[model samples]
Every structure is written in structure tokens, then in C-alpha cells.
Target: MSSPRISVILPCYNEESYIANAIESVLNQSFTDFELIIVNDGSADNTLSIINGFEDSRIRVIDQENLGPGASRNNAMRIARGEYMMFLDGDDWYREDALEIAYREITQKDCDLTFYQMINYDDETGDIYENDWFNLTTLDELDGKVFGPEETPGSIFDLSVGVCQKIYKSSFLRKINAEFPEGIFFEDMPFFYYVYLKAKRISIIKEHLYFRRKHDASITHVVDGKFLDTVPAGQVLMRIFIENEWYEMYKFDLLAYKINGPRFALRYIEEKYKIALYELIKKDYTEIKSSQYYSDFLENLGPVKKKFFLDIIASRNYQDFIKLNS
Candidate 1:
């Protein structure tokens, strides 16, 4: 058998209701020279059975114990045979021409990786919502930006994490050994940042190429009384700040984390500060305090923002802190 142009990986868990449609979306893609690898991550539902029902020989099913999406993707990448790899979540579906367009850019333009925008769909109502957060519309706008080299890293950190909406040359992925951290929530932020920094050239296609389903089951979703919610996903922001040494990238993450910390802290302390959570943030700040970067962060925090931090420390919860802001 000839090698396919792209390998599309779908990591499924308890998505029996949606897997058939997700599979149909990929099988129906305008580009036929692609392989689909669906990793069944210990789904208790009929997900595996539905996947087996597919007649396409291009689809390969790999059954494994539940290890979360990050690990499931890692397994798929390990055996992927295509020259390029596209990771899609099983519950979400893509536009017909997404792979065709992305692969065309990669092959013809010699771009290392290409990322496109996606629509957000409500799982309950089946209504599609366009995404506001991802800006994938124009590649020409980012022309002059330079990534350092293959060995040294640059700072276009958004590309690595959102695997589904992006196309990556298999050779580049092999060189970087890209994989999300297992057992961790928000695995993409770190993994994506790392991969983007290492790539020679990255492009963003602003078109909406995929539909990202949003509902109760998504990792990004928060629900009450669920173990995925109640269980400590830990303080991911603080860990990122402390573990990563790239200051340029560090500053970008810290700027966001620091701004959001007080809100997290308010939520943490309000709910009865877990000794673990408090230590995570305080220790993270303590470790980075002496870095000139930390001082730079403080100097850049405008008076109002500084006051907001102080208010968060003084007030009870986010709502009270908002009242203080008003």
C-alpha cells in the first residue's frame, strides 16, 4: 500500500453518540489520500462498536485503556505512517475541504505547519457558533515573523496545542517528538508552545475549517459535582511558570497567568484554600520573584491592575472583588 498524504487521528472516549458522524466527516473529506486512526480510550459506551461498523479500510482502530486525550494522541502518533499528521477529537467534525486546503499549503508552499480556525458547536442544541478566540484568517499578515531555527526555538506558541485544526509535516513532528503531557488538563498550552517555538515556519489560515463541539463532556467544560471537576487538575498556570525557562515565552504565559491568578486565588481561597493550591501559586511566584522578568511584570502592571491584585488578596471571592472594582 502507498503511504497516505496525511494521517488523521481521532481520540475517542464515550463518544458513541457522536463517533459515527465524526468518522463520516473525515471519510467524506474531499481529500481521499489520508488515513484515519481512531484510538478508543476505554470508552464504556458503544463507541468501539460504532467505529467497527465503518467499512472504510483506511480507518484503523486502536483500542487502549483510558489515558486521556493527550496519551491517546501520543499513541496514534507513534504508529502514524503518513507524511503529515492531523489530530481530531472524535466528537468534533471537520469541513469537507479542511484537509485538502491544509495539505495543499504544506506541500506547495513548503510550510512546516498550518493552523486554521474552527467553529464551536453546542452539543445539546446542534447549533454551530463561530470561534472568536482563534485568529487563523490571514497568513500574509504574519509574513515577516522569523522563527530562530530547528535547534534553537522561536515564540509562535499557539500552534502546538490545537492539533486537530492544524497540519504538521511528519518529519518535523518526529524531530521535535511532540506529545501532550499525560494525566494533565490544559496539556495543549505547554505542548503547543513548545512545538511552535521549535518550528522553522508556521502559518495561520483564517478560514473556519473545523467544527469544535462544546458541551458538558469537553475537557474545557466545567461541571458541578463531577470528579473531573472536583478532582484536582492542579494549578496548571503556576506549574508552567515554574517549569519553563524560556523567558520570552515565559513572559507571555506569565502575563496571562498573573492576570488570572488573583481570580483563581479568589476562587481557591473562597472555597477554602487547599494547602496544595496556595503553595503552588505562592511557591511559583516566589521562585520567579528574583528573575528580572518578575520585576518587569510588576512594573508593567498598571495602577488599576495592581489595585485589582490587591483587591483580590483583600476581598473574599471573584464577585466581591468585582464589587470592589466597581
Candidate 2:
């Protein structure tokens, strides 16, 4: 059998309430020649049953023990038979024309990847809002423009790290071995940087075609041990950068990313995890501090940003850090 032009990969975990809408959205896309790959990540609820209720042949369901989202996505990608790939969260749905527009633009542009605009839908209060966080619309000059990561250097970090907000050329992803890191939270951080850095061509869709659902139970609202996964996640990202020889070229952007992402994330996580998170951050920074690029990074940081890293390294414990911040 010939492969479809696009494959939609949806990884679900107990998304019984919203999976139906998610499935229906893809099955009803304006672009008809596509397959939907749903990974049931050991959903303990009626999610599997709900998924089974759908009688579409284009829908392929993979049942697996609850591996993290990273693992689920990897599994789906391995078996996905598509020229292009799109990721969808189980709780989110795409506009009917999303696939049609994205596929057309990507093909015409010959882009390895194309990201699009996403609006947030709050199920609790019925609030719908657009976030200008994705560089797609904010960088007006880049609208429908074909660009590459190496052309922008470290600015690759500036793009949205949300994997679901984009469509990927399956061949490019496969060629680059862009697989998600299992057993880590914020896996998308490293994964996004991984793919973007290796991408030869990237484009954007200015139209809002994806809906990101937000609710209390969402991972963003949770503060737990997994929050500390940001440290290891950052660690993995640092390794990718340094090993790829990007760390030296973009040390400033890389350090700033660490400070903004994992370091800053410490402020919101549970208090109990602070010491551990601190130690992890300190450990990573300590290694960087001794590296040859550390001085160069500090030079690029000016005064204020340099102090933040220094403060993290100099502090005896979280209390000292708090007192310094206070």
C-alpha cells in the first residue's frame, strides 16, 4: 500500500473527555489523504473504549504501557507511514483546513518543517485567547518565509518549543534521528532544539489552525518531582548543543536559555524539590563555569545576567539563594 501524504500522531493518556473531539477533528480534515495514529498510553479510563468506538480505517491505534509522552511519540513515529507528520495532543483539535494549508505551504516552500499559530482554549472558564509567543506571526518578515537554523544561529531557541504547533517533513526528521528523550519532563525542549538545529529549511503558517486546550489537570499546572526533570532535560539539551559544536558558537543564548527555562522554573516548583533542583542547576553550571566558554558567556551577559549564574554557583543552599533574591 502507498503511504499517506501526512500522518497525525496523537498521544493520549486518560483523555476520554476530549479524545473524541480530537479524533473527529482529524478524521474530518479538509485534506482527505491522511492517516491518524493514536497512541493509547495505558489510559486507565474510558479513553481506549472511546478510541475504539471510532470506526475509521485511517485511524491506527497503538496500545502500550504508560511510557512518558516522549516514548509514546517515538513509538508512533517509528510506525507512522507518511511523507509529512503532524503532532496533536489528545485534548486539542485542529481546524479543518490545518492539514490542507500546512501541507500546501510546506510542499511549495520545500521546507523541512513548518510551524503554525495556536490559540489556547480554556475548558474551565470557556476562555479562548491567542498567545503571540510563537515566532510565526510576531516576526512579520518571516511570514511564509523559508529559513534555516544555522542562518539564525542561537536564535533557534526563540522559536516555540511546542511540538504540536508544527508540521514536520518525515524524511528530514528521520534523516536527523530526531527522537524524543524518554524519561524526562520538558522533553520537547531538547527535541525542538535537536530538530531545528539540524533543519536545512523551515517555514511558518500565519493562520491560526491549532487549538491548545488548557485546564487545571494540565501538566503546566502541576508542581512535583517531574518539575525537577527540567534539570536533566536541560542537561540533555546542553549535551546536544556542546556535542554538536553549537555551544561555543551560541554560548550566550544557551546560558540565557538555561537561566530562563530550568533555573527560572525553580521558582514555581514545589519547595521540597528546591534543594535537589538547585543542586542539579549548580552541578550543570559548575561544569560550565570551568569550561573555556564560561568567561565568554559572562562577557556576553553584561552585569545583571552574569550575577544570576554567579549567585546560583556561590550560594550554599536554597535559603541563601532565597535571601539573595529577597
Candidate 3:
């Protein structure tokens, strides 16, 4: 068979309840020239069974021991045969025309990546929230808005880092060796960060092309030791910036992201792990502060944010910082 126009990588773990719908959504897409690579990361539930129920020739299932989403995606990419690639969680469904529109736009412009909008779907209440963060509206407004690191340095940082809601050229990813770090939570941030830096041209499409299901089982809703992976993920991002010598150019954004790690731990981590996580945060913060870019990042912050950062740095106490921010 000839290579498909797009490869949709859907990684699943214990998603029996939603995996069927997810697979059905892709199979029913208006665009048919795509391969749906479903990676079952050792799901204990009926996820595999549901995936097997799909008899479509385009659907390819890979069953393996649980290695987490990062590893599953990496494995899928190794075998993917498509001109472009897109990611979709096993619990989320795409709009019927999502692949059709994204494929058309990205191919027409010959861009490295194409980012579209997505709706946040609340499964409990069946409420759909439109994306307002980017304020994207009309096709004409988003058309031909191609940006690169040199043309608009900050624009890459502004775009959402979610691997979903975006389609990437297979060649671009392969050329840069963009692979997710296995066993790490929040791997999307670092992976997307690397892609943004390497991509020569990126285009934006204003249409909402995906439905991101919000549920308790999702990573953002679960609280556990794995949340600590955010620290290492941030570290990987910083290391990438330093290694690429892009630290000086994106220091402020990187610093903010690093600081947000501890802030997030303080707010959401379970009490049992808070103390240990705090120490990890402190060590990372200290190392970041000693970097040459730290002072520059601080100096550029506005007065209010600067004071807040100083207070947190000086306090060195998670509770105290929380109280001050609260």
C-alpha cells in the first residue's frame, strides 16, 4: 500500500471507556487517506479489545508493556508511514474535517507545522468551551501567518505546546530527531519546545479541529508522585536551550516556566510528597538562579512580578511563598 497522507498516533492506557469512540472518530473522518496507529501501553482494561473490534484496514494496533505515553508515541513514530503526523489521546476525539483541513493547509503552505484550535469538552456536563487564549477567529486572519524563530522569536513560545491540535511534517521531526523522553510526565512541553526551535516555518489555522476531553483520569486531574516529573521535564527544556545556545534569546520564558514548576507543586501536590518535592524545587531553583541568564530574566520582569519572584526566592519556604501569593 502507498504511504498515507497523515499518521495519527493515538496512545492509550486503561482507556476502555473512551477508546472505542476515539477510534471511531478517526475512522469516520472526512479525510480517509490516513493511518491510525494505536499504541496500547499495557492497558489492564478492555482498551485492547475495543481497539481490536475496529476492522478498518487503516487501523494499526501495537500492544506492548506499559512504558507510558512518551515511549508509546516514540515507538509509534518509528513505524509510522505518512507524510505528516498528528497526536490524539485515546480519550479525545477529533472533528470530522480536522485531518482534511489541517492536511490541506500544511501541504498547501509547505510549512513545517500547522497549529489549529481545539475545544475543551467537559464529559461530565457535556459542556464545550472554545479556545479563547489565542483569540483566533477568521480563516483570513490566520492565513499565511508563517513564523520562524528568527522572524518572530517569541511567537513560538506563545503557541500552545500540546502535541495535539497540531500537525507536523514527518520529515521535519525525523530531521531533528524529535523524540519524547520516556517515563516522564509533561513530556509534551519539551518535545514541542524542541520542534518549535527546529521548525523553519509554522502556520496557524483558526478553526477548532479537536475535542479535548476533560476527565478525572487525565494526567492534569490525577495527583501523585509522577507529578514530580514536571521538575525533570523543566530541566530537560532548560538543558535543551543551553545546549542549543538559545538560552539567552528565550531566557525569560524559560525562567518563568522553571519557576512555575515549584509553584505548581506547592499548589497541587499531595501533602505526603510536598516536603520532598519542595526540596527538589529548591535545588532546581538554586541552579537556575546561578545561570548567567537568571539576572537578565529578573531585570526584565515587571515591578509586581519581580517583587513576587524576589519574595519567593528569599523566603525559600513553600508555605510562606504560598501564603504570600495567596
Candidate 4:
């Protein structure tokens, strides 16, 4: 009945088979002073029945109509009673020490947000993969190259945007009014960019404490959808950055757009929209001298992956790129 130090918010849809294991992973965590808030986002399956079977007082369940993951997470966050917050997806489970380790690191560093790495697992094939998604040169290296509130420009530079990997201070969350945008497929991209910019200090742990399951039903595994939708969603975030005069961040955004955005737009035009793929190419591909980041991105792309899009941009071979599209 005592107040908990951290509140773990989980948003569940139709995840009956997976929710129980996800909950148990937290309950069995080496760190136990945390409450679990599970939001059943209008599941037609047995997700609710399974959640109700849990007899723990620390587990609080909220039932609401299907409102997308972002809104569900925001709803739970509003009623969260912990000093710190962490997100655990319904279909994914955390390592026994994830929350424990993240809590310790955040407090020790006095960081507003502390994030770590993730190990991705394939549900069907049992294939396992791990990477330091943050691209941290060293996990043990901290305190140096730290960014102050004013010194660091806001950017879309991080490797992953899964909200679940980090622990956030409740006060800091309130200041930014941090909530994922609702009804969008790529909601986290915008949410992370905006919130990270507002934070006074941020930190990262180099260890992998989270296990991300790559299930076919999950949005992440739906490559076709992501390939089609991510760019448009990223474009919206780009506009938000530009309108705010965070010009320095544009380099990061442009890189993101070039790397992932074109695939989404091109996929949409080809499969669903049935529009001319050539026209989807930037009509005015003039250089924008905003920052070295952007210029560096172009230089990096010139000799790299020889895709139709790159060929068009690099060689001005619009005809060739268009021919490949056909």
C-alpha cells in the first residue's frame, strides 16, 4: 500500500497470449517497489479476462475503447502514481534487472531520462539479435560529452523510439506534457523528438535490458506498412522542427528522411496511391546549406547503396530511376 518509486505503464490490445508473460516479467523483477498499470485498449480477445485473473494489489487495470497505443499510454500516464515512469509493451517483456538497473543509473547520474539497449527476438524462428542501438561508443563511458539544456539542439537522431527502454522522471514528464500523439502509426517518432528536446539532461546505459519480440502481428514486423507510412509521419516531425527554428536539427531530419523516408513515400505511391514514382522524387533537389550534418548526409549517400532514388539524386538520372520504377 506504500507509494511506489516507479510506475510501469503497459498498453494492451488483443494480446491475451502475451500479456500474462509480460506482466510476470515485471512482477518477478529484481526491483519490486513499482506498480503496474495495464490499459486494456478495447480488445475483443481474452486480454481482459487474463489480466483480471491477476490478484496482485500492485496491478491496476483500466478498460477503455480502442484508442490506439499512444492515447492508451497517455491515459495511463495521467493516473500514474510513481515518481518515475517506464513503459512496457503488452507483447514484449523486460529483463529481470531492466527496471532495477535503469533506476539505479538514472538516479546515480541525476538524469531526467535514462535509456539502455535492446535485444530483438524473432518469435517464429527463435532467432536472436542484439545491438547497441544508441550507437554509444562505450557503455561504461558516461559524464563526458554530456549536453546541457541549452547546449544540445533538439534532434531526431536516436536509433530507437520504443518508449519502453527508458525511465523518465515524473516531474520532467509533466514539464514537457510528455504524451505520445494519438491515431498515428509512427507516433513515437514525434513524441520522442519533442520530449527529448525539452529535457534538461538525458543519459543512456550501454547494456541491453529489454527484449523486443518481433512478432508477425506486431507493427514492427509489418515491413510493408512501415515502408509506406514512416516517411509521411517523419515529414510531419520535420515540419515541427523547422517551424520551431531548430535549424541545426534539420541535418538529422534530412538524413532520416533520405534513409527511411523515401522508402515509405515510394512504397505508398507504388502500391496504394498508384502515383508516379518519379514525381515522388524531390522535384527541387537543390542543396540546402543549413548545416554540416545535412551536407555530410549527402556526401555519405553519394557512394553508398545504389538505389533507384539515390541514382536519381546522384546522377540526375531521372529517366533511369523512373524506368526502374516501371
The model with the greatest lDDT is 2
Q: Per-residue alpha-carbon lDDT of model 1 for 1-326, expressed as tens digits?
A: 98999999999999988899899999999999999999999999999999999999899989999998779988999999999988788888989998998898777767677777888889889897774465442333564343233322223432224667688989998897777778755555556656665677766666788888888767656422222211122235334445555545456434544556333443534344443343443444455565555666566566765565455455555456558766
The residue-level lDDT of candidate 4 at 55 comes to 90
Candidates 2 and 4 compared by TM-score, better number: 2
Clashes of 2: 0
Off by over 4 Å in 4: 134-158, 226-228, 252-259, 262-326
For model 2, where is the 10-residue window of minimal lDDT? 134-143
TM-score of each prediction: 0.76, 0.93, 0.89, 0.78
**Top of the candidates by TM-score:** 2
| TM-score for candidate 1 | 0.76
What order do you get sorting by TM-score, best first? 2, 3, 4, 1
lDDT of 3 by residue, 239-320 (tens): 8988988888887767766666656665688888886776676676677578776686577766655655565666668787
By the TM-score metric, which is better: model 2 or model 3?
Answer: 2
Candidate 1 least-lDDT 10 residues: 223-232
Ranking by lDDT: 2, 3, 4, 1
Error of 3 at 212 (Å): 0.5
Better of 3 and 4 by lDDT: 3
Compared to the true structure, candidate 4 yields what TM-score? 0.78
lDDT score for residue 137 of model 4: 37
Two-way TM-score contest, 1 vs 4, winner: 4
lDDT agreement of model 1 with the native:
0.69
